[model samples]
Target: MKLIKKNTERGEEKKKRPKKLKRIKNANPSVVLDRHGNIIRRVDGTEHGDEKRGGQFLAALFEKLIPPGTKAGNKKQKTEMRKKPKRKAESEYNEAVPYDFPGDIIRSIKNTAGDFAGIIGGKSPSAGKAGEEKRGGIRDAAPIRKLSAIRRKFMSLSKAMRRIVIALSALFVALVSVCALNIWASGFRETWKAREASDAEKAALESILDEAFADERSEKLRPLPYRTTPAKLDVRAGAAVLVDTANGCVLYEKNADRLIPPASLTKLFVMYIVFKEVEAGKITMDDIVPLPELSWAVNLPRDASLMHLGQGQTVTLRELMAGLAVASGNDAARAVAYYISGTQEDFVARMNAECRALGLKKTYFVEPSGYDENNITTARELAEFARIYVTHFPQSIEEFHSLKSLDYPLQKNLPSWQKNYGDTLAIHHSNTNPLLGKLDGVDGLKTGFIYESGYNLALTASRNGQRFLSITLQGQGKGTKQGNEGRIHDGTELMEWAFSTFADYEPGKDTSLVFPVPSLASKGNDGKFVNLVPAWKNKITVPHLFGSTAKDSADAVKVVVDVPPYLYGGVKLGAQYGSVKYKLGEITLETVPLVADRSLESAGIAGRFFGTLAKGSLEKNR
Candidate 1:
């Protein structure tokens, strides 16, 4: 409580108390100790311990890296490290990291950092006015940022060529693939060009035969009237051909390509067109005739054959067809033409169109009536037409061409004005076909003879199911009787020869003869096999006797089925898979294409790719 003279009493106690230590200004924050634990740098009133130095890694590294020997005997270096630094160098070196390390690393790459970015440009912060020391440490005049020699060398080679190498490799692969595809395409192009050339050649050959056109001053196609030929029978006709209807095989041919005037045989094609129209529902045999003045027998030449048609006659198309077929009447032909197409010119145009459509190159018709010689055809071409005619209308033989005779102008054929004049008006015409009753199984076709063209006949006869079409043209003689006898004799010989030589056979039709093709069958077919059949009827006409009198059995013929070993998926329906060959000893008689029975889809990308590998392995194993 009594506080009198406090300052005087404190002064008296201070004289007896101990003295306190004082902290110095701008002194070292740490003490540098040598290995013996002796302090090199001391600071007043501070206790230094190893604990604080434990966290200062740089200071410890510097102490180990900087030995006493690198410090020169120069008094200036000693003074610079100990004294307080004024610029950035002093604060940077305050840590244990050496400031000269950058210069030591970059000295081999660059001698100096002259005019560097605001620092280390040929001078140091701690250097004296004389010059900077060039020792291999951070003291050299270097830029603020420096890199070693290895790092600078790496920067110069920065552009990598890896992407370029990869691109070139890809281009090389594509070029190789394109070259392979081009080679394959070239082969296909060559094959296509070859086919085109073959077709062009065939068309050219046909043009030569078609040169004997109507109304032209050309010579008749005459190749030896009596040729010692393959049929072993001398034919008196200029051109003749015997073709088996079963398989279209030519049994005998002699100048069959020669063109000649068809004469009355042109009616055969006229009847063919009429039959086609009937089949197409365009006309019927019961159609009434159009009795124009051009159709009356009065307008026709007196020598022209007729059914004695008069004006105001009530003839039907059926009667006209019979008259044209059996009587070979020119009047009936014009009348029938007018009945169907309004004009003979239009009907002739239709005939020509049908001829071209049927691929008969040498057969040309200027008029439907066979009384004119301008109607021309070749034996081979007529035979081809006869084949199609029979194939389309086999019944035409019984209905029209095979009739023995046609009697017309009866009560039914006469008009109402002449109904009571039946017997006086009636006319009888016998069949003009010379082979009708003379030859057995000779139903009909037609016979033609004109002054300019000799006798011509398109004859067909079927003894068994096998049939042969015989075309005999230009049977030359002095008169119509001689010409008629020649053609009839030639036709009868050819028909008999063909029937006895070749037999019609349909191969691979028997269910027991089904051919198994290994294809996509394993993948989709339940039976694990695809059944391949002939693409066509596969009917072959071959020698059943070969000069023998007896007919042979089917077992005597040899059938060879040729097919691929295996088939993969993606096969199309009706695609040709192989072939079936009909053989006789060493000779191959006929070959028919065997086609795939069904279509199959692709399995997948992976399945296709691996399937190819498996196929290769299969071949190798086989």
Candidate 2:
């Protein structure tokens, strides 16, 4: 009997057939699991094993689907099957057992029946071994035959999976390429926008100024370039500046911020402060300024701008300011200081306070005049301060700049010898602003120079209804041998260049694309359909001066729409439909959505009735 059982088991195992792959009629069979035990991705035949994040996802998914405690059982079964040669051929296991055996019963049976015949014989109490083997063979053939009948099913599914995989790969590559291109475009756009200048504007101005300068030079006009002779300055020891007022920008500079001596330029702030006081009613033109005797001895050589104040001289506050702004007057600065604060020291403290308020980032003053080296500032800071001063006190400053000279009345209380000094003498004063009485658009400003402060100008001008402020400093060159002519020429060249080669461009509507909506409405509650328009126009100014900060060319561009809440459906016009804020160097420009902001009218009377009926039917079914 034992020999008979052994033969039966061998025969049953040998007669087993291959398993049929499960499939739908006319559909493809599922793929075998990949190396990760994950079913191959149906979209693409490219196995999940080849993808970046697929392995971990597959592992997690397998962990969830497999039965609990089945891991060890499956591993043991696989190991035994590999060792047993016949196990590899035992694929015909298609029929499911009708009854579920108890766990304990199944375990005992599995342990006792080590081979195929043992299990079959247990199921049949008296069946012969030959019969058992024959029965097993017939049953095994059923699955193999079913698989053959459905071959067409799996073929179609596999082809579709291959196409899906290829398409997905192409799409991924294209998306990556677009992202890279956008990044490159952003950086290039910034680089192009930084140095945008208007060459055309400069050319037009140059055509005019070059003729003026050439005509003056041909005549060898004294002080035409506003200098006695060619001179170079050692800016390392001190500094100065010259400015063009037309472009509202800088012209020339050299260590202008380096601390040295602030000559009469310190009085520029004093003038600004006094004017502010006058505007605020703290003082007036008629207010008396008590002259101080010591002010005359503050700076040696007496070259400083002054009205030669004597003690007890009662000078009007307005006259004192005129002397300071026009003549760089030290004595006038002192008189104003004394009249306002009763002491020069207190007045200097106020000067320091005003500097901070004006956004003069690099200025500090120790005295009212440029005599003290301790009082100093950068040309840029001075220019900014001057611009602020001009903007605030346009009338007074303009009058001050307009002066060619001034006269002082003899002090009625002065001694006989001093009486001759105070007279309405012909004071021939030249305009100090480099561009003053020079450039057509140029107007009155100030000029400064000291052994320690070099030549400086805080200039401003207007052209085509736009104003500009520029400053030049420390152009005295390496030695006193250098000339202001070169500095003046440099300032002119800079100003002329600024007005050319740049233009403001408004974003045209053609680049805009709109999404169409079947339903649209009008704000008047009249029109049935309305198209959306852009809310704001986008503008960009191109070709600017080197080192100039980027500015938005668009004066007022934004979004216009037909609907109140533009996005009514799940679909959007495009990825860039909402708003795009682009950066060109330091400038930020924005574009808004072009969407149809309209809706279908509350259905006409008949349409509303039909909708109501439809709603009723749905309600009744529910």
Candidate 3:
């Protein structure tokens, strides 16, 4: 092949014909571009001579494309061009080129060369420069650099350590997930448990109501006791209360709502239950109750006061009650409870039920005997209970509570053991109540003592026509004997103070019938209003000084009438309708039930039809 050489110094091209080109063995291959810039293979298909001239031809072609004064050919010129400072004019001229054709072509050629170099040399020159740039960027700052160093160190470690780190990360994530699940589960479980507990409580209350209303005859009794708030008083007992039984008025109280242990004062409820049984005709006083094994066991304890009935002995209900009331016999109390309700627990439940029915809050009974400290009540509630007791079973007080003493198994038939220890095992058990005979007109009440409740008493007294009931609990004393004395002393002082400081007052006959409630059925004179009278005629009491007479005190007291906004027509004569409250200033002295003096019949069918029409017309117009 012949080669053409360029004479750049003289700026001329010279063509020289050489000898036939010799092909070199194993020479690198070369390619040529046609006028269209496409590669063309040699027609001879020989690579030997082409390899020697191919590079020189491409260099010469590139030199022809570049403009004059551009330094791009020689390596030393390239170095000098890079070191030279650019002139202002040249820089502006370079920026003035609208198209970046030369730079683009140069970049393309470099990319192509890099690709080929990577294939041949296993790495590109630009790749190393790019990695070095990345290393010098912001990511190479201290924090990131330290993190990268730690990563490198971790990678350098053995496989076991790397696995340990990965496992720990997994375990941490798993623990967080488990804790979250536990919190969610606990919340759901607590909410479900609370819901179940509320449901159970509702069911229990429903069952209690069912049992209480089981007997049809139970309807005959009052469902809820009347309530009254009176002036506060300072009394020297842990708890004290005074109530007017005839009218259900709470006259004076101190810590009356505080729950306290009742001790044997619980016997009052026992007696109340027994009286209910008697009224039901379930058992009579003369009826005999055989001593059960439980009842006989009462005598085994030295601390417990018993009726002294033997193991196989039988006793009349009357005798048992006497023992309960006068001697405060725990055994007698238990016997009465069991006899009436079949079990002491059942009887205690009955007591609590009755308490609830009577609207007594803060009262609970665990056992019938009240020996357990769990038997709890408030002074105000206990006084209310006593009022109901005496009002319903007046004979109980006279028959059993009034007795000064009683001889069980009578003195005539005393056994040799009792005779030998007559002083210690006396047949006569004196009434536990200290005020029975000591205070005039103080008939029958009960006294109680336990380690928990220092001393307690429920006392009733009457002077002339005035009746008063009082309770004193937790009286101060050093011992049981001293406690009993303190209770009696407090009771006496309270009674004396009440009777001396207050007098019973009755409003005049004209004022007694204050409210004339119109009957809904009444229209004409024949169906006139019914006169409502106070249920308690002379039951109102007031504080009085030494010189004050009942008349003067009654004049000072204010009478407030409270009647229903509307009264239905079909009313019975002498039936309680409303209440009359007596007050002195802001202090309420008493409240008495207001009753219908005359019966009012329901309106006839014709009257009712017209009445309904009239009522509707009035309502619509208003």
Count of clashes, each model: 3, 64, 1
Task: Please give the TM-score that candidate 3 achieves against the real structure.
Answer: 0.51
RMSD of candidates 1 onward, in order: 21.2, 25.2, 29.1
Candidate 3 per-residue lDDT over residues 249-335, each given as its tens digit: 556778877888888889888888788888898889988776666776455467876777665455788988898888888888777
Task: Sort the predicted structures by TM-score, highest score first.
Answer: 1, 3, 2
After superposition on all CA atoms, how large is the RMSD of candidate 3?
Answer: 29.1
Q: Count steric clashes of candidate 1.
A: 3
After TM-score superposition, the amount by which residue 317's alpha carbon in candidate 1 deviates from its true location, in angstroms, is 1.3
lDDT over C-alpha atoms for residue 354 of model 1 = 90
TM-score winner, 1 or 3: 1
How would you encode candidate 1's per-residue C-alpha lDDT over 11-42 as one tens digit per residue? 65222334332222222234455443344444
Q: Which ten residues in a row have the lowest lDDT in candidate 2?
A: 218-227
Q: How accurate is candidate 1 locally (lDDT)?
A: 0.66
